[model samples]
Target: MVDDVADVAELGVLTASAAEWSVAVRRAEVIGRLAQEPRVRIAEADEAATQLGISRRQVYELLKRWRAGSQVASDLLPRRSTGGRGRGRLPEEVEALLLEVIRSRYLTRQRRTVSAVYEEVVRQCRTRGLAVPSRGTLERRIGRLDPVASVTARQGADAARALRSAGGEPPVVEGLLEQVQIDHTVVDLEIVDERYRRPIGRPYVTVAIDVASHCVVGLVVILEPPSALSVGLCLAHMATDKRPWLERLGVEAAWPMSGKPREIFTDNAPEFTSEALQRGCDQDGIKQSYRPPGQPHFGGIIERLIGTMMEMVHELPGTTFSNPAERGGYDSQASAVLTLAELNKWLALAVAVYHGQVHGTLKQTPAGRWEQGVAEGGRPATVSSETAFLVDFLPAERRTLTRTGFTLDHVQYYCDALKPWIARRRQLEKIVLRRDPRDISRVWALDPDGDSYLPVPYRTMSRPPISLWEQRAAVARLRELGRDQVNETALFAMVEQMRQITEDAAARTRRARREVERRSATPVTRRTPQDPAPLPPAAAQDPAEGEPVRPFEVIEQW
Candidate 1:
């Protein structure tokens, strides 16, 4: 039983302190059984309550949480500060004050000591009648700040530049697809929405580079922040033929570099180190390698490649530039024209151009080097189906098959594919499932008899597809309205309302911004009024729009 408990805790399903994990495991054992029951009887509830040493009412509440949380062990994990390493204990106003003070004082050229900063923070907090954060809390917060940014702000730009070096020697790799390095950053440009052509926000770009040939193995641009989903998408982009993606972009270009890498080198980010990523790599016989915690140069290849890509983006409209000094007196959003799709297309072309350019270190075009590497290593293996390959890398869940179907977060999934599994449900304990958070309308369940996965769609097919975030938001909204029991209909209705509100808000925001820009414009002189009123300055168009630019950077290296 002890060994079993340890094994359960190691499954990565629940991350918490030891005591918290033990409680979670015990609760999962009880609640997981209750959730799977065709019908929970009073006797069963009494027994579970006694086992967990909790009230019968609390047992029912736990059962509800377990069922609604996709039957994961984490659903039962303690939520308070004592239970897990989560929950921001500080008040919102206090937290805001801490951040403001830290940014305005600590991260400056003055280079105040942590002790001095803490003293100042305490004085200000007291003056504002707010709870002061402990010294350790402030220190930890400072540690979590962007390292390069912190260094640059305190030490100097040159000192920060030194930290980016991979040390004295570069890592050595053997052949094609031997080592792939990936990293992501917010693109230095604002992109517009397709519907309104108004600047929505900057998107993140994740890039992967093959170490041996220095060829970009994969790239994905998304409006969302870096997460397991984005990482999986980027990896999928890297490990498949780029020609299909390029074709979809309708751009004529050659991007033949494609295949699964022997190993991946990434930064020590939570998303990069997720259990899903590790399991996926294990299943595909791929190795996982993290950049050394103190070494910045180990990830230099991908960083430099990303740097080049951002430079290319700098040439596009609405570029915020590398820093505020570079963007002096410029209004990025005012000139923004490209939509997300258009920016993606533009990036596709930029990548095509970059691939043909000769690398300073390799002394050969990335594409040419890739061809040579293929000649030497005889082409790396790649997956035929991107979705099938990606399913393993997606977030994992476990659910018991019911007669009707598998219900998760109040949504039931069913299909003919699950009919056989449903019949033999008693034979199996719980089957593992994988879900793409972007779309929760369907999930892939692992087959008990075989290694194949079966796609399970929503039992109510007419239910509009919604993201995991949308579902959670809808649930929260329902809870706020004192509607504890949320049905599929109610949840989706709330989602629709939320989406409509967002659309209306975005329209209003765009109109307001345009009006502000018009009002804030510099007045033309009277002399210009006499000279044909300067023809209204031709509307200050973005050159990237209304025309396609040839790749002046592309090198002829056939």
Candidate 2:
């Protein structure tokens, strides 16, 4: 018997596993028996239980109770029957309104919390004069409604479609030195010059990063756009600072040694496309590449660095301009000087901290990553300092020579180093002159035929201004000589012009003084009268006659 019972129990468990309501038969039977009715035939109980798939024994018990008059007919109906009408758990109209509100307000924001949604539900219920549901109840209803979920699913689908249209490929950067990304960001601090203690201008930060190692190879903060001049300066600094690493790696100083870069990524700013920048890159054998319009993420590494710089700058003390004139204000020069000194000190400290600290992405300091890459067989793809200086230091210009061996702008230049080249070029009549933008005191003449450049020194002098007494003396001398060399009428006209200029200058000075006086005298606000004063005419009148009279003159007798 025990063995048979075990077998039956196992069979029952197996039968109930895949069937929906076999396990709930006992609970259903209890509910049905409690809800059974009398007088209406007991057959109704068995029929209802059979339709619900409950056991016949449970149905018979319910019918027995109904026959005993212990239950009601209404109780024998289906659990959810509305007497004869069908109704939803929540009204269809209310459900639709809830869905609309959730879709419009909560789903669009993408930040709908359960509490926030509950508050909104309560507000809606109050407006409609309905009882506010409990938070749990509202939450359960929302789960059943699931409108927000549908909206989110739609949004995700749209995003996936966009990704598919964009080719849906993960960004894969190529080999080391294959691509270099450069960009400029404004540093967040107000920087002032050390010498003047005045706001110099907003500092522009330019960064060059190796796409493979994610290392900052070059960084510069200049007070202007990333011009070719700025680029050259940064390159020169890198050559000096990064030389030991490059030497250790046995790499040549000239950049793009193996081949030109696959791409040189930068923004579509004017400086990136300037003639000077183009020529410089051409000389260095680098090909330029630009990011797609409005796509900063394409060059996100540098953009993140810019954010870091801004955070650091913001943490520092607020900067003040010492030179009021720099920002068009009135302030102490001493304060401006102090501010400038502090700015430089803080900037240096910040840069040092940044260079020493380890970067999260590179897992090493920027300088360290750069060195490691160099030591690990990566070549320093940069031009030699001497060669770079020779190519970029000279500024070329198109000019014609004058009879006096001078160029336009009255610049007379000659360099002893170029004597041999100039001697050979003298036969060519004219040559292109390249001057140094930094120092206009010297210029270089290029001999295309000889494949040589000649340096020339420039001599500049200013003629002195003629004095008034000197002009008069010259006129008298001309008259004594009985010569029409100096025209007296013209000389007087010149004197008259000078007089007019002096008069205009004096008038300007007086006007400026008057303006200062007016500003000083104008009251900021009217003062209340403390004591009244007699009118001028009233004070001057005699007391006896109450009329104005002139004062009598008296002479002192000794």
Candidate 3:
């Protein structure tokens, strides 16, 4: 029995001490005997305690302790600490000031370094003429401060509330191709230049992720903001490369490419709401769903993909574009392009690996699940590829009317196709042309096929100050021709006549003003008479006088 008890003790059924069981049993017996005694309970209790090898006073004390513990347990009471010590270290006011500094000086400026904050605190102290604390003391103070910790907690609570209000539980993607989320994320990376030996640009990375597969189907990196072009390129890539996977899975390779994803989800970005995108979906018969604004969790799959890209960027050799030798002194544009190229290369490899590997969520690889779906006879939805192409190609633009037919981007294009219709309805003046900003080569005109689009080449007209060289040359030629043909003599004669008439009018006006002034003022008497003009001598009288003098002299000499 001792060996059995030892075995029981080893198994934890009984404790190591054999006396413990005896003590417990004796205590229980004493309590039982005491309960049975109605009158003279004190004497009975004393007899029971003596029989149990415990004192009557000791038994009463043990019962009282046990009852107190039981009451405490039943009440779920908390015991106070031994000391009445207040909170340690920093005062509430100081802690609050620390948190304010953290928010205003640190968080707002994105300066998360503790050392930086320490220096700032010292600077502020010096400016305020307060005693500056040591770095360690400041750190301790910071630790004591909550520092808007509740803000994050409150945000999480609000997100939970928003998720609840969004309605409907999140869909459980069972297999690959079951669901896919498409979205664009801006990636900040320095793209290095091969020729310039410097980083040139930063570009945005638009990605489409398969939720169940965790595969990046398509990715496009462009310098411009996320536009319809970027989105279309991504979709086009998915349609081309993943066609086999889509076909084998009996997924619709039609309009809404990606096999009419059970549901298409994206954020409420303007590009997603563009007419081109909407028309493309209409052509593909794909129903698009938009997530609530500022609620990224609804499209968490793609948002997480963005986070993964950011992580990858962080792990790169240079986190910033400042490294001239390493990342080639790249500007935002160069950085963007290089990052996109690297991202694409990495994405391709990652996607291949992801699709080949068995997914934890789906319990099968994407390729495997796709094959299974195909074998299970999933119907591929029919969509017109032509219609899809048309919708994707169509560009959104505003309509405008111009004098010379229709002007698009300052280029006038007269559509022969639209001419007849305009003439028949006499709506030539009302006919407005809308051109795609992306493809200025094509003007939006009514074509013969009754489609309101006609291809017109893009051209620019010269303005007044900045006329084209050809226009300037033509103007110079016209001026030269006019100069050669014009009569200079007639022009001079006309100018002379005009000058004489102007002088005459000015003299008359001066005389009239003088007369008015003389009549208004006191008149002054003339001091001297004007000299008379000398008379011209008559030739006949002068010759006669000279001849008479000569004849009289000749007669006296004879």
List per-prediction Cα lDDT, in the order shown. Answer: 0.74, 0.47, 0.47
Q: Tell me the tens digit of each residue's lDDT in model 3 across 427-456.
A: 433433333233233344433333334433
Each model's TM-score?
0.62, 0.43, 0.43
Distance (Å) between predicted and true CA of 506, model 1? 3.0
Model 1, span 487-511: residue lDDT tens? 9889999988977676666666764
Candidate 3 has an lDDT of 0.47
Which pairs of residues collide in model 1? 165-297, 166-297
- Predicted candidate 2: what Cα RMSD to the true structure? 31.4
RMSD of 1: 25.3
Model 3 misplacement above 4 A? 1-168, 172-179, 193-197, 212-214, 240-262, 313-346, 377-395, 398-405, 414-420, 425-438, 444-454, 459-558
